[model samples]
Target: MSKNSSTATGTSVSSRILLDAVTKHYPGQSKPAVDGITLEIPAGKIVMLVGPSGCGKTTTLKMINRLIEPTEGRITLGDEDVTNIDGDQLRRRMGYVIQAGGLFPHMTVAANIAIVPKMLGWSKEKIKNRVDELLELVSLEPAMYRDRYPRELSGGQQQRVGVARALAADPPVLLMDEPFGAVDPITRQRLQDELLRIQEEVQKTIVFVTHDFDEAVKLGDWIVVFSEGAHIVQYDTPERILNEPASSFVEDFIGAGAGLKQLTLNRVRDVELAEAVTGSPGEMAQDVLARVKEAGDGHAVILDENRRPLSWPSRRQLSRLETIPATPDAAIPLVTQGSTLSDALDTMLVSSAGAALVTDRRRSFVGVITVEVVMEAITRSRKASAMANDNDSPVGTNTGTIEVQGGTT
Candidate 1:
């Protein structure tokens, strides 16, 4: 995958959160805006808060950042007591993103992005570099957008700037509230991909909130489903949530197409990989052994001189001088380099031949894609969806009846 390709997975951070009976109440309300809810967000990962509008999902999210002070319980980040930390100090170290980019109409994009850095009193050179870095990080060109005012940009651009601004100070934690909510669907998806790429490179602890169930499934490392008064109906991985819901409430909320929703979290392939080793398709085997001495398993992946997959050699073929076509299973076909990780995984699983050839849409082999890469891609895709919504279909669950609450919706 290209560094910027949709499926990049390299992370060292462990994004974790611990909330002990966190609750928020309005003065006149009979029930808490956020009821007694306890949850954990794993470190260096994206945890999504998803539910209906009045479900207190947003309220649950805000309490973590102290945007809305919890009326009860504690919020902890890593091992620190976030509830007691200085709110301003806590915020500076955390990334905050809201809908429509929240860019200041009066400020240039660079200046809007520079707000956090300037507050942190970073040196002029430091802030300038940070601003530039953030623009590129969010896929916005620095030279193109730095001097432009928010009014001059489109909604998506503004949101990108907002994200750039939130990430400007390089906070270890991120709080996102529908960061892509204000844009058109296509633009939202593009932004979602861009954010995924960014998360892969930056590995921050992220808490993302979305109203869409599909978005929750697509982007979450773990999803926390809420209902009236911020009740946590379920807190689990997207796969688990799809396969096993917390209750009928959770099922009803996700609605009629949960199986199709599964595809959003899955691709044609995941769960496997092909080792990064190859051999010449038509070369002499005893000679090829001299080239790749440690392929280990008494077999070598045969490739054309141009690096396209040909076949996997049998032990006999490994020593034979005469040409014998190896099992087609020897060489697996790869789909697009950045096709959904689930698709690649599905291809590998369905092919059932150890590994599959990873190719672009043109059917040219890029390299071998194994289950490992597919899993990594799944991780990245889920992380990307951590901040977005699973608003579309999943990988392949779209066949027959989709039982809601284990029954028909």
Candidate 2:
């Protein structure tokens, strides 16, 4: 498997989650809210529960941590039977994030993240270090944001803090319920990209619930399509779910342009980025233009003192200037290697040069992703998906069902 690929095993500090014949029936309802469902969430992999409104996806997620008690069946985490465990104790071992961050307006960012650790009786010094570490992990500078109240932060920033709080105790499992649904489209995309990047580092077992099918395709290693009453419409990888719909219900749920959706499966690192002529700020524009001409390139990427991208100027723009500008261009399009091809394409579409700059984890410029590269990636992905669907080899199959035996699955 690739570095970004999801598997059953890795260097995960997490445990697998299993639900066997789990059902949740309401007090007075004629039918159960969540019918009998059996599912296995692999260690360190993200499993997404997706369906229309009124479906039991959210109910199923809450039952894992016993936020809502299950009327029947077993819930196991690793080797332990947690179905009947103390609800408060069980919840402390898992991280949960909900819509709009669910932050308390009165608390500062550091205090918010320190809730779980403090409840666990961690020392003040330890909690402080943890808060700073988590804040940095979520791409927020600790010193600046830690002292601010939740009401002072933007919607996306508040969501990042919520995630930080959930991971405060370094729990083995994470449960998210439409965590990014409340944000604007652009911020939502950034949050998705940030989540993927963070998952690469933490590798926790994440069970996410969303009504958006496209969100499921982008974030989930395994997707569980749920019908009304929480029936398992299809439990499979995103690739299989898109290429081979189990029923007409799934086909309509996927809606139009299944081929276009395949672009979400691949990442920017999967393709070879085109190299651009690079120069530093305060460097002679004539020298940089010479290198651009020698390389047969139309643009040159300007770098700051730390080797971070500052601007991407064309040959024409460079010819009129004597030296590269010291100030960074706020409008420069940027994407990280972990970003999906779909996101890279979106960034490039709004760029005047029809390309986006590729950055490393440190935000340093690596290369350029052009429209042609994205188009080629989309084409290759379509062909690969088609070929996989035609073959009977079961190469990419991931049936999320595990047989329970001896109190374990």
- lDDT leader: 2
Ten residues in sequence with the least summed lDDT for candidate 1 = 1-10
Segments of candidate 2 deviating more than 4 angstroms: 1-14, 284-294, 315-326, 385-409
Model 2's C-alpha root-mean-square deviation from the true structure amounts to 5.1
lDDT of each residue in 154-257, candidate 1, tens digit only? 88889888888888888888899988887986467556756766777888888899987777776777777776776655666777677656567877877985
The CA lDDT of each predicted structure is 0.68, 0.85
Model 1 stretches with alpha carbons more than 4 Å out: 1-15, 268-409
Q: Indicate the TM-score of model 2.
A: 0.88
Q: Per-residue lDDT for 168-266 in model 2, tens only?
A: 999999999999999987688789988999999999999999988988999998888888877777777887788877677888889998888888888
